[model samples]
Every structure is written in C-alpha cells, then in structure tokens.
Target: MCDEKQLQTWAKDTLSRREFGAFSGAAALAACTPGEANGTDANTSEASGDVTESSVSFETEDGTMDAFFVHPSGGPSPAVIFWPDIASIREAKRNMARRLAGEGYAVLVVNPYYRDVAGEQFADFAAWIAADGFDAESGFALVAPWREKLDADAIGRDTAAIVEWLDGQDAVDTSRGVGAEGYCMGGPFTVWSTAAVPERVKAAASFHGGGLVRGDDPKSPHNMLDQAQAEYLIAVAQDDDAAAPDDKAAFAEAAEAAGRPAVVEVYEGDHGWTVPDSPAYAQAAAEKAFADKLELYARAL
Candidate 1:
C-alpha cells in the first residue's frame, strides 16, 4: 500500500484538463448550483427549498471550528459529519452538504485545516492545485503545515469534539446514531470517527480518499476497523486503485475479521470525481457513490 503522505501528495498534484462543465471556468457558479448538469440525477431526494442551511461554529480543543450545517426543516434527522478534501471547506462542499441533508441527514461539513486557518482556504480544489503554479511556486507551501497536523492522533481528538457537539444538537436525532464521510485526505477521518466514538458513529463513508491502507503505519485506518462499530463504504479512485490494488482486499479482510460490514470498490473516476466543482468530476460515478452512501446510512444509521 502507498504511504499516507505519498498518497496525499499524489492527490495534491492530480490535475486534468478534461472538459468538466462545473470546473471549466464556472466553479463559483457550480458551487451554488449542484446537480444541475445531470438534472438532479437519481440520487437527490428532495427539493433544495426543503433544506434548512446555516453557517455554524463550535468550540473544539484546537479552537473554534466553523462549519456548514444543513438539514431538512421537519425535525431531528440522522447526522453526518463531513470532512472536506485538501482544499478545506468551500462553497462546493456546502452545496454537497445541503444536498446530503435534503436526503434526511443533518450534515456538518467541517474545515479540516481550521487548525491553521478558518474559512475557505481556496476558491475550490482547482484553485488550490493551481496555487503556486501547481507546486513550482506555492502549492505545497500552503498545505504542508496543515497536512502535518492531521495524523491519526489529531484526527481522533477532533472526531471526539465533533461527535460531542453533534450529540447535543437539536437537529440531530441521537437515537439514530451518526454517519461520517470524507473525501481525499479526509477519507481516513471516517474510519477515525468510528474509533473515536464507537457507539455514536454507526456508519462511515470514504470517497476517492487517500491513505486508507498503509503497510508502514501502525495506526492505518484499516488497522482501527476493529475499534469502530460502524459499517463502512470505501470508494477508491481509479488511479488510486492502480497504485495500490492490495489496499482494498486488505481492508475487506480486516473488516470481515472485525465483523464489520464494509463495501470496498473502485469507482469509475479520478480522485476528485465526487465534488461538483472538481475538474475530475464524473457525474455518473459520483451519483453511484452518493447512492451508496445514502444506502449505507439508510441501513446503518
């Protein structure tokens, strides 16, 4: 399996000029309008107007962590904690959160880099990769420090705090349990959520996430599956699977050994396929992953 640091590096440098409607030049516009290209696809559950959205802040051990919270207006719903990719929280993520909440979930999209900076770190992932001219000028410089602080121990602490805040929210139906999902570097955060709060986090999903399986790391996400009582969905990027084909098998075996149900598959898209504003977004593939996440939550949460 690839090293966690190396896997994150690969995603940071991944860029495609393929014609993506959302990422071509209208990322700002797409961030506000999700599911426009595919016309709401089969995955979207309700109209956007039914979703109540807001910008919320909660105190964590590191400091204040600002996040986007959204849910259906009826009452308490099953909760989902979203960990954004390397670009951190942005409009694109809020769009995704709102959509998730529309499907009967109270979603929280957190800024993974809030320890270093608050608010949107980049306009979107494309801007993040383009920063410093894609590594020549300022790319790594901007993200390296924040990345260093996101190891397993730190993730555990933050997961605890996030779970604590969610447990007491009026919009969260605590009896239903919670689900956590992440993309890219945020992937393992889902697994970490299970270990951080086994009783509350009953479902976890990772989409095109990196570093799920690492041979060298004792605290690899797969290694902690036994500690988490949640069922899992690990969606791998096509290129990521090519790089470490054994990771999925390893994860499946570990899950089975731990008596946890896990669905591990390589979706038909690149690393950033699920996010609408990503240059690599593949509508069909992302819709499939979205459906899987909903199914997991429906059954487990």
Candidate 2:
C-alpha cells in the first residue's frame, strides 16, 4: 500500500536526518551482529538459541510460494504464519522467525510478493531504499503493482494454502491452533488468514499494518472480524495514529460489534519500529510489542 511510503515519510518527519542516520546505522549493525549483543529485543534474543531453519516452498493458487521456516528442536510446536512488510522475506525476517521459533513455535516467514517474484526481493529494507534511489515515492511505486495482487481475498486464499502446508509439516503441531502476525503491508493479511482458516488460526496480530480499516472494502480486516475465530492485537504506529486517529477506535468498535476480543493501541514507536532493519527501530517499543505478541499466543494459541 502507498500508505507504507507515507509511513516512511512520517518517520523522517518525526526524526531529524542525523537521528535517522544513527538509527539506521545501529539497525544495520545489529542485524549484522549475532544474538542480542547489539541491543536487540531481549525476548527475541532469549528465544534465539538453537532453532532450526530452512528455505521451503509450496504450491498456492497464485503460484509457488516460497518461505523461510524455522522451529525449535523439541517436539512439534504451534505454527505461526509470519507475513513480512513491503520489503518481503530477507535475513531480518529470518532472524525474527528464528527468535520466535526459539520460543517454541514453528514459524513460517512468507514472501508476500511471491505471486510476482520468487525468493528474496531485497536483502533488507536498506537494499530496497537504495534500489529505489532513496526516494519514498519511487520505493513504494515499485511495489504498488504487486500490491494490486494482494487484496484481502487473495491473502485469504494464500493463508489457506500456507496453513495446509504448515499442518502437513512434522514440525507443526496440528492439535494446537495456529497464530498469524503481519508487519506493515502484511498486517491486514493476518486477519485475512484467520478469516480463511478460523478453525486453525486462533490468534492474529497486526503491527503497523495499513489498509486494516478500508471502509469501502467489504473484505477489510475490520469487516472480517466476524469471520475470524481468533482474538487480535493491533499495534498502531504513533505517526500512523496521528494521521488516522479514529481508525483505532473504529477497529475497537468493529471488534466489539463482532463479539471478538481485541487490543488496539497506538504504540510509542514510529512506523517500522518493531522491525530491526527499519530506520525507525525502537528497541523498547519493539520489545514491548514482542512481549505482547507472546502473551497473546500463550493465551489464545
């Protein structure tokens, strides 16, 4: 969604160029460093031990879907579908998955742009920015075409296929309900995932996801709550909240009307704060968000 580009602009507006440079430098360094030495989220770091990872793919209605799968060495665990932001799957996402896997969950980090391209589109957010000539508009413009193919219906279909693949894996425990978490562009996809396989996906979380409250779309994430059996956690970016202050309330009202439990809050971090490769990475807020996600999964999954 173009809103993703707006989020980038918002981050720039909130932080001076020098400050952003420092954040980006630190994020890049942290991403390159192993474990939690660079002040990565403590929960994510604690869960980073001894997790197995692999590159895998499965057939979807759109095409072959490629993903990075990771899980603990122990017995089968609850499956978690990770829908990455606009940059698509890369080392940052894989590391995030590994951290979650260490927490005893079988994590699948999906390439949301798989329909248009296979494998990693960018090595990281920095790569994407560099490729786009460091222009926000052009950066999002490159993905705008791909976004057209990722509507709620399409994401729901993909989620169904993904859940089926996860269930068939030895690492995934089918007995326990699945969970889905999406970042940026992937956020609304989590709701679509739950709506597609309500029986399997019992929990969903959206971090700074755009298009969640598409009032005109019948299949908007807010409108699909009744179709989902899962509880939700919607973490809004501070700048995004400032731009659309009523969207959070709208989400709360929609969930209440649908009789679905949800926690919708505007977090202190700017857009992309939860992601390690983003210029807006805020360790404190990202850690809080991760803790909240683990709590949600523990309670619902």
Candidate 3:
C-alpha cells in the first residue's frame, strides 16, 4: 500500500536526508555483515550475545520457504511468526527478529516471496525503491504475481506449515502459544495465521496493515476473527487511518461481535513507520507500537 507519493512526502517533510541515509547505511551494514564463527550460513547470521540466529528453510505445499530464525540461547521460548512487509526478508527484519528474540521469544521472520524468490530480493527499502528508479509502481508490479498467490487461504496453509516447523525446533516451547506479527500487506496474514492454527497462535499484531476490512471478501481479516482464539493489536498508521477512517471502527465492531479482545489505535506515524529502514520511521510511534506488541505477547502468548 506504500506508494511513491508517500515516499516523496516522507522524504520532503518527515525524515530528513541525513537520518534517512543513516538508516539506509545501517541496513546495508546489517545485510552485508558476514556470518559469525558459529553461524549456519555464509550470508545469514545473527548469533550474538544472548541470542542465536541463522538462515533456515522448510518445505511447504507451495515450495521451499526461506526464513530467519532467532531465539534466546538460554532455553526454549514462546514462538512468534513474523511476516515482514513487501520488501521481504532482509537485514532490517533480521534485526527486528533479534530484538524480539532478546525479549525471550523464538522469532521467525519469513520471506513472503519465497514461493517465487529466495533470500532477500532487496537489502533494504532504499534498495527496493532505487531498483525501481523511485517509482513505487514498478516495485508493486514486480511483486504483484507473488502477492496475488498469497491470498488468505494460501497464507493459512503456509501458517500451518510454519507452525509445524516451529514446534519441531528445540528453541521453541511447544507448551506455550505462538504469537504472530505482520506489517503492511503482511498484516492480514497474521489473522489468517491465527485462524489456521488457533490452538497454537494466541496473539496477533498488525502494524499499518492494509486490506484488513475488505468490502466483499468473505475471507478478509476483520471477518475472520470468529475463527481465531487470539487477541489482537491493530496499530493503524495515522495516514492510513485518515484514508479509511472507518476501518478501525469496523475492526473493533467485528472483534466485539466475536467475543475476541482487540486493541485498535491510530499511530502517529505514517505507513511503513515501524520499520527501521523505512523513510517514514518514527522512533516514538514505533516504540509505542513495539511496547503494545510486547504487552499482547506477554498477556496472550
């Protein structure tokens, strides 16, 4: 849902050039960093201090799915399935997984485009935009096919497979419930995940996610909560809320009707704000969403 217009607005008024460059530089560093001595792959490595991470792959009904798995080295922890935004799996997502892992969760950041591509297609959002010559339409065009295949049913199947894989890992605590978090287009996937395996997934958080309240789609996220046994945190970007002012209300109504607990709020940031490598990243808003995410996990997972 992030377009070139939003990118221009962010650059012109939100994030200064220096700050944007700094974030981009940090993303590049993370993406280019070599694997640690005990890392599992040449290009994938997150092992450090209290957490251990590595690139991993598993088979799904669709194809071989690649992901970044990170967890505390101390012991097994509650598992969390993280669905990254359209940029796919990259260093920024890996860093986010590490942060959640440090909070004592076994975090898995999945590449949503693995059905068509493996590893990172772009190292950061900047790279993604640059590759398209600053035209967001091109970036959208590139992923349109892959994105189309990721309907709620398809993501539900993937979620089942991901949960199976996580349960098999020694780093995951099967006794505890799993948590699900997603951004942008990945947001509705969290709802599908909870519905896929309600027995395992207990909490879900959607940040600046789109298409949550599809008009006639019976499988839309707001319409699927009746199938989930999870609580939710829906962090709507301020601009996104402005565009669809009734969506948050719709979500709240749906949750209440289903007897499910949900916290829906319009964040101060714009779309793509929660991601560190995004041009719209706002520290205060991002941190607030993070805190809300942690609270949901703590209470439900």
How high is each candidate's TM-score? 0.86, 0.89, 0.90
Highest lDDT model number: 3
The C-alpha local distance difference test score for the whole of candidate 3 amounts to 0.83
Candidate 2 overall lDDT versus native: 0.83
How would the candidate models be sorted by lDDT, starting from the highest?
A: 3, 2, 1
Q: Write the per-residue lDDT of candidate 1 for residues 172-284, one digit (tens) a residue.
A: 99899899999888899899889889989999999988888877577999999889899999999887788888989999999999999999998898777787776667778
Best of the two (1, 3) by TM-score:
3
Q: Could you give candidate 3's per-residue lDDT for residues 103-137 as a string of tens digits?
A: 89999999888889898897677666655555545
Q: Model 2, range 151-172, lDDT digits (tens) per residue?
A: 8889889999999999999989
Better of 1 and 2 by TM-score: 2
| lDDT accuracy of residue 77 in candidate 2 | 97
Candidate 3 pairs with clashing backbones:
none
Candidate 1 residues lying further than 4 Å off, grouped into runs, are 1-48, 134-137
lDDT of 2 at 68: 83
- Per-prediction backbone clash count: 1, 0, 0
